[model samples]
Target: MQKIKLFTDSTSDLSKQLLNEHRIDVVPLSVVFADKAFKDGQEINTEKMYNIIDENGKLPKTSAPSPQDFIDAFKPYIDDGYEIIYIGLSSDLSVTCQNASLASQSLDGKVHVVDSKNLSTGIGLLVLKAADFINEGFSSEEVAQKVRNLVEKVETEFVINTLEYLHKGGRCSGVQNFVGNMLKIRPVVKVVDGGMILAQKTRGKRKKALKTLLKNALKNKKEITEDRIFVTHSMDSEGAEYLKAELEKEVKGQVIITDAGCVISSHCGPKTVGILYIKK
Candidate 1:
């Protein structure tokens, strides 16, 4: 039987170690600062992006890879006679999936593109699920079907330290209530149906927001997968440690922690944290 290949974009925010462990192929998105552009994980890093955003008072423009980029990444695996599955970020969130879809046309039916309908570690969870199925000797088609089934099962949400980034990035204009009041209103944002939606709102205090995050998780703990849980943060290493400890106490499996990548940080800003997992 031919080997199965798994691919994801940098927006998945998977760590280099995790990607290497699974031998997962990754296509990078671009974070552009004016005329200059840098690869998501290669040329520029999350820290540099955050520093630039701080100094510039604006978020850098993020762009998905062109079809050519995905095409190049797909060709090698397809040439190796291995079936290809490219799991992508949310369609509503970015054009990454569309690019992957366009690239799929170059290959035969051997290449499959899946819309994770998620971003950050939400996308990572689906990729891991596909890897799990492949490890069980499942075919590419089987992996695709299994991952798609797990897509909705994977729940994703985050709490930003402030909504300033959203306002500065011109994303949350409609939520003018949180404009100047972001310091006092910490909204728990969730990924639902391929878009970011406000899940809950708490006090301006970071601790309050964290409690809300943990509260929601505990309420829904029965539905979350017990195998692995991801605690993803944009900086906030200390907060990630606390969140990971709290999560490990409630979860049966290992708690994997990762810092969100530059592309993701550009939108959410710094000091943001999220807990991601698949449903049981």
Candidate 2:
């Protein structure tokens, strides 16, 4: 049987090391700052992007890879006689999915594109699962169906330390007032269906919000296992580590910590805390 190739973009928040270890391919998305453009993980690093955002008072805007970029990325696998499975960030959030689909159409029948319906490690987690299925000898279609089913089961929740970034990006529609008025409140945001939704609002401090986030994660703990919980942060190492420790204490299994990439950090901003878990 021919091996199946798995592809995802930087929006998945998957690290280069992880992608290499899993033998998954990643197409780079473009990050634009002021007038210059850089490939999401290729041309710029997360620290550099965040530093620019901090100093410039604006997060760099992001763009999906051009159809040609996807075409070029998929060509190698097709040449190697490997079937391609491209898992991308939610279509509702980015045009990456559409671009990948268009590229697939151009590839004839060799490439398959899938909309993860989630973002950050939420989509990364699904990519990891798809790789597992591929290794288990599942066909490309079977792997795609499994991913689609699991995408619905996975959930993401985050707490932004401030709403300045959201307000700046014009993504503050649902949580604007609450985030603006309550300086003491930390709102927990979740991905519902295909969009980001405010899950709960609470006040106190960052630590308290971290605690609340984990407590809420445990509410659906039965669906999670040792290796399934993914904790991501936007340049908030201490907070990410804190959440990881808390999850290890509460969850029945091990928790993994991943850095939020430029694509997600652009929206969530720095000091954001979040957990992506597969729910029962």
Q: What is the TM-score of each candidate against the true structure?
A: 0.96, 0.94
- Candidates in order have lDDT scores of 0.87, 0.84
Root mean square deviation (Cα) for candidate 1: 1.7
- At residue 85, candidate 1 shows an lDDT of 91
Q: Report RMSD (Å) for each prediction in the order shown.
A: 1.7, 2.1
Off by over 4 Å in 2: 173-182
Q: What total of clashing residue pairs does each candidate reach?
A: 1, 2
TM-score top scorer: 1
Q: Candidate 2 has what TM-score?
A: 0.94
Whole-structure CA lDDT of model 2:
0.84
Off by over 4 Å in 1: 173-183
lDDT of 2 by residue, 79-173 (tens): 88888999998888888899888888878788878898888889998999898899899999899988888888888998887776777788675
Report residue 224 deviation for candidate 1 (angstroms): 1.6
Q: Which tens-of-lDDT digit does each residue in 1-280 have in candidate 1?
A: 7678899999999999999999998899999999999999989999988888778876889899999998888888888888889999899989999988988887888888899999999999889888988898888888898888888888888888877888888866746645537447777899999999988877766888887887787788878877778989998998889888998788786799998999889888788999888888
What C-alpha lDDT, on a 0 to 100 scale, does residue 235 get in candidate 1?
Answer: 86
